[model samples]
Target: MRHACFLTVGPARFRIGSDWRAPIDQLRALYSDYPMDEVVPDFTVRLQATSALRRFVRPQVAIAGDFTLPDAVPLPLHHGLLAAEMAMNLQMALGWRRHLLLHASAVSRQGRAVVMTGVSGAGKSTLSALLAERGWRFLGDEFVLLDPETGNIAPFPRPISLKNAAVAAMEHEIDDDSRFGPVLRDTPKGTIRHLRPRTEWIEQMARETRPGLLLFPRFGFPRAVRRMDEAESFVRLTQASTNYVALGERGFDALTGFVRSVPACAIDYATGDEGAELVERLWSETGAGAGDRAAAA
Candidate 1:
C-alpha cells in the first residue's frame, strides 16, 4: 500500500493501493482523464505481495479488497496493472448495489444505449470498442450498470481490456499509441492490453442513456439474427446480472420491466466489421433516435 491512486468512473469511485509503484503509475496514466480528487471510494482495491518475502523476491501481486474470491490467483509483478483492473471488476461484481450490474458491454448513440452480453469469446468487447470508435459513445466494456428505478444505462467508461487477438484488432482500428497501456504478455487471458476510452466519452461518463436494444452476440459464426422473446431475454439477463439475486424484489421488477421495454436479439457474426454493421442495421430498425420501443416489437 505504498503507492495509491483514486479514480471515479461514472457513479462509482475507487481507491487503489499497491505494494509497487508500477501498477499505480499505469492506472494513473490510463485513467488520466478521469476524476482523481481523493473523494470517498465506493470500493478499495489492494495489490499486495502474497507474502513478506514475495514483496522483494519474485513479487506477485495478490488482489485483495472489500470483496474478493476465494480461489483468486496472484499475478506476477509485471502484470500488476491487469491485477488492479481485475480487482476493480471483482469489487463491482460483488459489492455494487445502487444499480443492477450486467456482465455486458455497452455503447450509446443518439441518447440510447445498446447493451451486448455474451460469453468471453463472443466478441462483445471488440464489437463495442469498434462501435465506439466509429461513432457510438463507449459506455463500458465490463459491467453495464442498469438503474432499477429509472431503467437507464449508467456509463462506466473504464478502459477496454483487450485480450489476445482483440489487442491487435483494436490497435489496428485506433491510431493513438499513447491511449494504450503496456502490453502484458502471457496473462491468464493471454497477452492482454488496455485501451483507454476517448476523452470525450470519459468526460461524459456521468450521463445516462435509455436502454434501446439488447443483444446477445456470438463471434466466429455465420451471419444471422434472431428475434428474442421477452421470456428468453429475461432469463438470459438474469444469468447475465451479477447482483440480480441480491437485490431480490427490486431486481426482479427492474429486470422484468427492462425486458418488456427493450427489444432483444441474438446476433452471430464472423468478423468485427460484420458485427458492427449488423448492430448499426439493428439500431436503425429499432428507431433508437425516436426512442420508440414499439419499433422492435
Candidate 2:
C-alpha cells in the first residue's frame, strides 16, 4: 500500500493502508485531530484491489485487515470511509479483550454514563448525538467500551454515522452546521452521513464515567419504558458483546458485575423529543444523583 493513514481512538490505535490514495486522504482529513504519536497501531487495515483482474477491470476495494471474517466481501472504493470505519470496528469486536465491548452508543454527564444498545434502526447513534447537543458529553457512537475492572466507560468518541432519515433528523435537531461530514449516497444503509461529535467529547475522551443506566432503545414505536431484569439484561448483553465468549470467566464476571451495578430499561419512542423527555423523567425518578437499578423486569 502506497498511501497510509494512522489514528488513535480512545485506547485503540489503527493504521489504515490503501492501494489508492484518495481513501487514505479522506480518512486523514476526517481524523485529522486524532493522535499519531504511536508508531505501531493496535490493528492494521488494508484496502486493496479485490483481485488481479478486478483491480484494473472494475476497480473495487476489498477490506482486508489484521482481522477479517471468511465471508467478508469487497466494497466499492467510493465507500472507502465506511470500509475503514467498519474495519476498525471489526478489530474492536473480534480482537479487543482489554474491555467489555458493547455494540452501543453512550453519553456522559456529571460522572454518569447512559449506554444505549439495540437492534439495527434503533436510532441509538442519533439519540446519543442528540444528547450530546443538549447537555451530555458524547462518549461514543459505535462501540461503548466498559472496563471490566472498573466498570467505567472509556470514550471511543468517533464520528456519529447517520443513515437515511437520521441525516434529516440531525439537520433539523442540531443547530451547528460545521459538525457534519459529506452526505454519501447509494450505500448499504442508503444515504449516509457522518457527524463529528462535539469537540468537548474528544477533549474528554480519556475521562471515564460510571454506568448510570443501560437502555434498550426501539424507535418507531409508541412511547413506553419498561424495567429489564438482570437475568434478561445479561442474555441481551451476551448477544451485544462480540468478545463475551472469548473472554470466558473474565467476561462472565465483568458482565455480571455490570448488570448488577446498573439498572436496565427498555424504551420505545416515535420521535427524539419524546425519547429525551421520557429519559429525563426516568432519571429524576431515580433520585437525581444516584443510579437506581429497576427492582424487577
Candidate 3:
C-alpha cells in the first residue's frame, strides 16, 4: 500500500489503501466531509498493483479487502477511486451484522423515510438525489441501512454515483461544481460521475428515520403508480437485500414487519419532475403517520 485513507459511513467504517497515490487522493477528496477514526476500521480495502512492473507501466488495481468475491477482477489504475468505493460497499454487503443491508436508495422528509429498490436501471438513485434537491434529506444512494431490531433507517449517504443521462439530470438541478466529480468516460456503467451528499445531511447522520413507504421505481416509462401486496413486496425485497438470508430470522422478522408497517408502491415515470410530483403526493397523503412511527421505532 502506497497511500491510505480512513473514513466512516453511517455505522460502518472503512480503511482504503492504494498502491498509487492518485486514487487515494481522489477518495480523500470525495469523502473529505467524513471524519477519520483512530480506532480500527470495520473493513479494509487494498488497491494493489498486480505485479511490480505493473506499478510503473499500465497499473492495475487488485481489489483485495477483508471481504471480497473470489472471482473479482482487477481494475485499471485510473479506476482506483471507483474500486475503493466498491470495495467499501463489498465489505458491508458481505460482513456487516448491525443492520439489514438493502440494495436500495432512500430519502427522508421531516424524519420519515422512503426506501426505493429495483433492478440496476430502476433509477432509484436518480429519484433519491432529485428528491434531496427538492428539500428531502438524502439518506443513501447505494445501500439503505435498516436496523432489524429497531426498524429505523440510519443515514448512509455516501457520494451518489450518477451514470449516463442521470448526470445531465442532476446538472439541470444543481449548479454547485464542487459537489460534482470529474466526468469519467468509458467505464463499466457508461459515463460516470459522483455527487457528494450535502454537508447538512452528513452532520445530521445521527437522526434515524422510520421507513414510511417502499417504492419500486422504474424510469423511462409512462406515469403510473401501483400498490404492492405484502407477498409481492416481501419477495421483491428478499431479492433486493444482500444480507437478508445471512441475517436469518432477525432479517425475516424485520422485513416482514416492515412490509406490514409501510405502504408499498411501484411507480413508473418518464422524467424526474414527474417522479418528484408522485413522491410529493404520496408523502403528503401518508408521511405523517410514518413520522409518528419513526419516533417509536
Highest lDDT among the candidates is held by which one?
1
The TM-score leader among the candidates is 1
- The lDDT per prediction is 0.93, 0.84, 0.87
TM per candidate: 0.97, 0.94, 0.95
> Global CA lDDT of candidate 3, please?
0.87
Poorest stretch of ten by lDDT in candidate 2 = 288-297
Model 2: residues with Cα > 4 Å off, grouped in runs: 291-297
Distance from true position, residue 225, model 2, in Å? 1.0
Which one wins by lDDT: 1 or 2? 1
Residue by residue across 1-297, what tens digits does model 1's lDDT show?
699999999999999999999999989998999999898899999999999999999999999999999999999999999999999999999999999999999998878999999888899999999999998999999999999999998999899998899999999999999989999999999999999999999999999999999999999999999999999999998999999999999999889989998889999999999999999999888756464454436
lDDT for model 1, please. 0.93
Candidate 1 error regions (>4 Å): 289-297
Give the per-residue lDDT of model 3 (tens digit) for 1-297.
668888888777888888889998898789888877656989988988889999989998888889989988888888887888778888988998888889999998767798989998889999999999988999999898889889999889999999999999898899998998777787777888999999999878778988888989999999999989999999999999899999999999888988998888999999989998898888767754455456568
lDDT of 3 at 235: 95
lDDT-superior candidate, 2 or 3: 3
Please identify model 3 stretches exceeding 4 Å from their true place.
Answer: 287-297
